[model samples]
Target: MGATVVQLTESKKQIQHTHRTFDDQTKAFRSNPMPSISERRENLKRLKRLILTNQERLIEAIDRDFSCRSKDETLIAEVMPSIQCINYTLKHLDGWMKPSKRHVSMLFQPASNQVHYQPKGVVGIIVPWNYPLYLAVGPLVASLSAGNRSMIKMSEYTPHTSALFKEIIEGSFPGDLVSVITGEADVAADFSAQPFDHLLFTGSTSVGRLVMKAAAENLTPVTLELGGKSPAIVSPDVPMEDAAQRIAFGKAFNAGQTCVAPDYVLCPSDRVQAFVDEFRTRFSEMYPSIRDNDDYTAIINERQYARLQSYLDDARAKGAKIIEINPARENLGDGTRKIPLTLILNTTPDMKVMQDEIFGPLLPVVGYTNLDEAVHYINERPRPLALYFFGYDRGQQQYVVHQTHSGGMCINDALMHVAQDDLPFGGIGDSGMGHYHGKEGFLTFSHHRAIFTKQKFNSGQFVYPPHGTSLHKMIYKLFIR
Candidate 1:
């Protein structure tokens, strides 16, 4: 019990230290509230240079955390997007900073109106484990571009990457300018409880609720980037081979750990077998061997691996047809963390695989009789982070767009919409809320201040303070109509 008391005291000290650091950063923001455009650009350049110079080290650290994260996957999914976001912000930030003039009515002819974008103070970003680098840096790019200081809370799950990021940030910028915090769930809870100008969280919906609840204590505005069961629909007009390969790429990338990864596929009832065959073939071509394949990514840890295995077991016990796609026919249970990509057919709504967001490489293929059925099936559930439609028919695409609601949508492609610098990325309903990307991101972290100016001319003195004069009658007649 004495040892426990010592441990408790140490933990209390750690929490107090973190709180003090947050207060110091808040005070720093007060010291220099607004930074000039040149200063903001310089900060962004420093960040880009740091990442580019240490690209190899960051990749290795992430790989070590995940046990076997593909280096190419990190480059494509994390590094490339982060660098592109920085460059995109640099190219358009000047225009984004400029205020827009508004038209003033003739009645108020002497006055002019304009909306200026100003930075909110300090922002808090909560990073998730799956895509640690991109999720952390993505929001930082937006926060800095808007000229706001920020503090990032890295996930405890990815310790190697989190520790490395903290060190890199310390070396790159002052703690008050930008800081990184690393700790377990208790630390995260304390971090979220602190009052920030704005808070951005990217993780599961269940956890998002908890973060939001904590943020509510301070009435802090929040931007939630949560995940749900995103679906991929294959139109009857599209060929099975084309649809299957694209969908396979979306599901197989990151071993299906991405927030916007395709959770399931909706195939026409008559073409289910053909689609399945094509998907298996495409997955094999991409990864010939699962056990020893460098291209194939392993699940992050034993807990998640076991959870996915349990999902499969629960589905199989419910009489669903489970097809494991092991092209090399390797032993999956011999102490390897990598699980062969498996496809579950004949899934029911009652099955666990159909109920939860399948974050693993398991795909549940649902056969729908028509497009309306697929759309209805999706609409019946909570809105997803992304929805994919594979077809060239413009009418059908528009119909799907009008009929369904999601955070974002991709036509004839998968997972590419999030990469577009011009589009806003976010989720709706249970998936999440608020957008952060491109101009929307700038606006998300900015306060659009409305200003009005009037000339020294005195036109309103004619009707000043009189009960009902001829001028007042005339003015009322002219303007009130």
Candidate 2:
């Protein structure tokens, strides 16, 4: 009982300390509201240099957290995108910072209209376990570019990566400018509850709701990047091999732990077998041997691995055909957490795999009779963060684009839209909300203030309120119409 009391007191002290840090940062921001463009650029450059100089350490740390995360995958997915976002922001900072001129009516002729983008003080970012570096740094780049300080909350699941990230941040930046907070779920709850100018969270939908609820107390604005069952549509007109390879790449990458990874594939009923065969072949060629393959990533932990296995078990028990695509068919001992790449065919709506977002390497192939059926199948579900369509025909692409509502769409490819620096990446409805990439990211972190300047002219004195005199009548006659 005495120990419990001590722990409680310490926890309360930590919370108070965190709150004090926030208050100090807020005070600092108020003192220097608008940082110069050169200062912003230098901050970005320092951030970029930090990542570039320590890329190997970051990759190894992430690998340690994930058991075995591919270094190439980290470089391609996390590091490259972060650096690209920084570069993109630096390239366009001047134009983004400039005020835009607006047209004014003749009635307000003496005044000029313009909109100036200003920082929104301190921003809070809640980073997820998967893709921790990219998710955390992406938002930081945007916040700093917009001349605002940020405090990032790293996930407890990835401790090694989170610690390293915290160290890097603390070494490079002052606590008030850009701080890193690391703790378990309780700490995350407290972090979200704190008052911030803007809070961006990237994680599962269930937790996103709780974050939103906590933020409601402070009335803080939020930008949620949640995940859903993102579907990949394989058009009958396209080659099965082409569609299968692309979908396999999307699923196989990160062991299918990505938020925007393809959750399932919609293939024609008659070509389902062909697609499966091609997918298996492509996955085999990519990895060759799962047990000994360095390219193939292992599931993060035993809990996640067991959850994925349970998903497969539930699907199989419900009469779904499970196709395990292991080219080597090597024995994975009890200690290994790597789950073989499997495809669940003949999946029904009642199956668990179909009902939930399978954040594993398990791909569920749903057969459709026609294009409309495939599109309708996707529409019936919650709008996904990403929708992949494989086809060469422009009309079908346009048709799919017009009919579907998703955060982002990629045609003839998978997971490439996220790499584009210009596109705004986000979701709608159940998947997520608001955008944070390129200009959208800048806009998200900025509060655009409209400014109107007037000359020393007596243009408005003629229409002063005098109970509708002759001048007022003349002005009304000339301008009211």
Candidate 3:
């Protein structure tokens, strides 16, 4: 009973702290509502320096959190991309901040119209466990670039990394300008409920719905970066090795915990077996051993491991062909929580693996007779975060691009589009909404305030209050036609 009381008290304290931090940040934002571009650029530069100086420590923390996160994978997927995003934003911040000159209709001549990009005060960023560093820093870069004060809520699942990140950030920036909140699921719920200028969440679709509902209470605009069953379609004419190799890398990188990872493969009916064979070959080449291999990342935690294992069990029971590409054939049943790149063939829509977003090293192969069938199959379900089509045919590529809907796509490649700093990354429907990256990122966190300057003359006065006046009629007659 005493322990329970203590627990409740601690929970309440954390909730209060989250609220206080948010309030402080809000106050700070109001004081310095519009930070100069130089200030914003300095913030990004400091962030980059922090990441670079503590790169090894951050990697180690994530490794400890995951039990065995690949250092190379963390560097490539998290650190490198974060620095690159900051660099890209710094290079383009000036251009993005410039007021856009807009055309004024002749009806309102002698007036100048422009759109000023103003920061949306304080932004709330909720980072997911997978790729914690990059996910947190990527949105931070966008938020800082837009000159908004920010408060980040790091995932509890990644405690070590989250704690270290909070420490690092707190040491560099004032708490009111940039605060980091850390705690369990309840704390996250409380964090989401806080009133923010804009909230950006990166996580599963189910959790995203709750976040949106919470944000709605405050009428806070939200940018949800949710994950779905992003698919990879292999064309009949494409080389099996090429398609399989690329798909394998996408599905195997970070052990396929990526939000934009290729969840399933749509292959030509006749080439399914060949594609699987090549994928197995490519995966084996990538990591010949899984049990003791540092390059091979393990599932984040035992809970996630069990969830993924249950997926395989359900698929196997449903008469799906399970192919385990354990090249070394080592028994990974140990506590390493490492599962080799497993492929599920003969999948039915009724199976859990097919229904849910497989956010692990499990890839399901669905055979399609033609491109139309493949496109139709994708359209029937919720729009995915990403889509990969591998083929050299320009007409077929155009057809795929025109017909399908996804947050992003890659032609003749898989997962590489996300690495591009210029493209705007986001989803369409159930996958997600609102983009944040490059120019779009800056715009997402900014309010495009339309300004019209009229000195010594008000053109709108010509049509004001009095009806059917000679001047008003003349003006209407001249412009209406």
Model 2: pairs clashing at backbone N, Cα or C within 3 Å = none
In the range 1-481, model 3's lDDT, one tens digit per residue, is 9987886787788788888888888888889988999999999999999999999999999999999999999999999999999999999999999999999888888889999999999899999999899999999999999999999999999999999999999999998989898887888998898889999999999999999999999999999999999999999899889998989888999999999999999999999999988998999999999999999999999999999999999999999999999999999998999999999999999999999999999999999999999999999999999999999999999999999999999998888888899999888787889999889999999999999898897777878886888998888688777
Q: TM-scores, in order shown?
A: 0.96, 0.96, 0.98
Global CA lDDT of candidate 3, please? 0.93
lDDT at 1, model 3: 100
Candidate 2: clashing residue pairs, number? 0
In model 3, the Cα lDDT at residue 216 comes to 100
User: Whole-model Cα lDDT per candidate?
Assistant: 0.92, 0.91, 0.93
Candidate 3, clashing residue pairs? Answer: none
Candidate 1: regions farther than 4 A off: 1-14, 458-464
The clash count of every prediction, one per candidate, is 0, 0, 0
Q: What local lDDT does model 2 show for residue 84?
A: 92
lDDT by residue (tens digit), candidate 2, 1-481: 9987776676576567678779989998999999999999999999999999999999999999988898899999999999999999999999999999999878877889999999999999999998989999999999999999899989888999999999998899888899888766777899999999999999999999999999999999999999999999999889888998899999999999998899999989999999988998999989899886778899998889988989988998999999998788888757667888899998888988999889999999889999999988889889999999998889999999999999898998888999999999998988888899888999999999999888899577776777589878877899888
lDDT of 1 by residue, 317-393 (tens): 99999999999999878766888888999999899899999898999999999999999999999999999999989
**Order of candidate numbers by lDDT, starting with the best:** 3, 1, 2
Among all candidates shown, the one with the greatest TM-score: 3
Name the candidate that leads on lDDT: 3
Candidate 3 deviation (Cα RMSD): 1.3
